[model samples]
Target: MSSSDRLLLILHIGFAIFTLGPLTAATMATPRFIRNQNLVVVRYLNRTTRIYGIGTLGIFLFGLFLASGDFAKPWLSASMTLFIVALVLLLIVERDQRKAAHLLETAAAKAAPAASSTKTGGEGAEEGEKAEKAKAAKPAAPGADIAQVERGRIAAMSGVVALLWLVVLVLMVWNG
Candidate 1:
């Protein structure tokens, strides 16, 4: 591999790990927590998408350089295909989460004025705000309703990616 190719591969691997790390971390959270409109999942997924998408794109670009020379093998092709698939899956999952997050935030914002206005504009205001926050703090209901469906798919996506990278590791070591 050329210096650029090797550099791209290293960068891509770093991106892959960063991309998948949120997935693993969010999965460790409860399903309701993962799907909640709290923005935690949204931020995590968005970051995951940006890093993984940009990183793998760089890899794909560099793959052109690699393929022009000594690295254009069948295994490399398969690995590339797998990598593309993984990126697509990650994007899909993150998109859904983003949609859900935006929707929920909007709803909460809408409810906020009404909720706050209801207070008597004194200690009641403080109490009402506290209550509203408490309401928000509680995890949103869990289901595959929106993002949950994509969240469910995350494991399969992660598993396939793990398998893909396993093949990559094997080929890299064995010169396949």
Candidate 2:
């Protein structure tokens, strides 16, 4: 195959991976911890958060390289346009994840009550402790649910991206 073809393949795979990796991570790892309130998993995703951004950057740069060049047939332009919009939607999805992550982190670090409380050796102290625990037990307001309606939007982005790839294939293999 030609160098351009090799590049296209790399770009296409990289872009798709970049777009879909967090989706998999969020969907898979999230459910594992959301119910249990696990910190390690959240930290794992947060500390390495740059992967999502860098992968997205890779997708934008590589996908544009593939699209702007006339490697594909002219009839595939509409498909390319869909791919572009799909990338945009993917970026928005990433932003929403970040927002959710931030909220989760905020909830986590403060999950326990402040340490300044006096646990004096008395029944009154026991009552105070129970009250504090009760107050802290209230569920935190999350920025977004992983299972929210926006997730549907994210899935639609993937579907559109797949559609674009199909269009490109059709234009190149069957129609060209």
lDDT tens per residue, model 1, 3-51: 8767876775565466445544443342344455555656665565555
Candidates' lDDT values, in order?
A: 0.59, 0.54
Instruction: Give the winner by lDDT.
Output: 1
Candidate 1 lDDT (Cα, 0 to 1): 0.59
- As a whole number from 0 to 100, the lDDT of residue 21 in candidate 2 is 60
Strongest candidate by TM-score: 1
TM-score of each: 0.63, 0.49
- The parts of candidate 2 lying over 4 Å away from their true place are 1-74, 114-176
lDDT of 2 at 46: 38
Name the 10 consecutive residues with the lowest summed lDDT in model 1. Answer: 24-33
